[model samples]
Target: MEIAIIKYNAGNTQSVLFALQRLGYKAVVTDDKKILSNADKVIFPGVGNAGAAMQSLQLTGLDKLIPALTQPVLGVCVGMQLLCNYSEEANTNCLGIINTSVKKFVSATKKIPHMGWNTIYNFNSILLDGVKQHEFVYYVHSYYAALCNASIATTDYILPYSAMLQQDNFYGVQFHAEKSAKAGDKILLNFLQLT
Candidate 1:
């Protein structure tokens, strides 16, 4: 199957490419509208500032191209945050595929960036197939999407936030499934098998 990784100016593209390669899938990393639209599956992975990233996407016209994709689209980390309605990262607006906003972790005792491994509580999703409930997943982010109506899974560091989101053909994950272990691989495989 053809998998396209949306190549914007954001970071973390190489790691995701490597992960897909490890899964025996050679994914194409591109920003062309036609290439992205024609893919069987699309993965949006980013690790960078929201405002700047959004600006870059807008510059390349990918900001509009991504949400219009008809195939199963997956967003990881910051890519997931950008799929929401808005983000407080830079008081920025985002693709409104999911009606949620990104918020900074309010922790006086813990830490700001919710790093390391955390358990993801699965509710119900095709992406969670073969993955156990409350499975541990790797995360590294300061902002999080609040658990809204579209939330398919939840995780907690300072408080419970959306670990996974789903709306129609669009799917998003706050944690890095590419970094998470076997559970992560299962999640990717599940997304790849989406029909």
Candidate 2:
């Protein structure tokens, strides 16, 4: 299977690549429009600021290319945040593939980043296949997509937020599925099996 990882300046490409390697798939990281559109599956992995990430995608025309993807596309962490309509992180507009707004966490404890492992509920999506409900997944994000119509799963931090989102062939996850260990790997495997 041909899998392409959208390479921008957002970071975490190697980690996602390692995860796919463990899964027995040799995925290539590239920003070429033809290579991306021709791939069987695409992964957009980001671990950076929303505004900067969007800037990178736009500079290379990936901002226009990503939302137009026909095959199944997965966005991780900030990559997922970029799929929304807008982001409060840097007052940036995003790809708008999911039609939801990403917002900053209103933490009462001053814990802005919301780091470490968190449990996800309402795992009815195929991406969570063979993974147990309420399983802890590694997360490291200060912002989150609000619970919306496209939300297929939920996770509670300061309040309930989207753990997983799906709209047509686009899917987004708030946590780092690649770094979530067994549960993460299982979810990645499930995504690979998507038809």
Candidate 3:
């Protein structure tokens, strides 16, 4: 199947490409609207500042093109945050595919950027199919999407937040599945097999 990785100014696309390669899938990284829309699956992965990333998406018109995708679309890291309604990262507006807002991690002792591996709990989605609850995933973000009706999985840093979100064909994960090891691979494979 053809998988298109939305190419923007965001980092981490290469790692995602590598991960897909490991899964025996060849994915193209492009900003072309037709290429993205026609793909069997689309993956939006990012690891950068929210405001600047949005600007990049706007430049390529990908900001508008992504939400219009009919097939299964997976958003990773900041890519996931962008799928929400808005983010406090830079007081920026987002795609609004999911009715949620991103907020900074409020911590009195722990650091702002909740870096390193963390366990994701309360899993309940097709993406989590074959993946156990409380599975450890790699995460590196300061801001997180709040738990809402669309939330499929939740994680805790200072409090419980939406770790994974599912709304129809749209799916998003706060952690970097490309870097999350075996469980991450299963999640991607599950998405790939979605009807």
Each prediction's Cα lDDT score? 0.91, 0.92, 0.91
TM-score per prediction, in order, is: 0.98, 0.98, 0.98
- What RMSD does model 1 have? 0.8
Q: Per-residue lDDT for 10-67 in model 2, tens only?
A: 9689999999999999999999899999999999999979999999988999999998
Q: lDDT of candidate 3 vs native?
A: 0.91
Candidate 2 residue 32 C-alpha distance from true site, Å: 0.6
* Between candidates 1 and 2, the lDDT winner: 2
Per-residue lDDT for 31-138 in model 1, tens only?
A: 878889999999999897998889999999888888888899999999999999999999989998899899888877997688999998857798897888888999
Candidate 2 lands at a TM-score of 0.98
Clashing pairs in model 1, backbone N/Cα/C closer than 3 A? none
**Candidate with best lDDT:** 2
Which residue runs of candidate 3 sit more than 4 Å off their true CA positions?
none
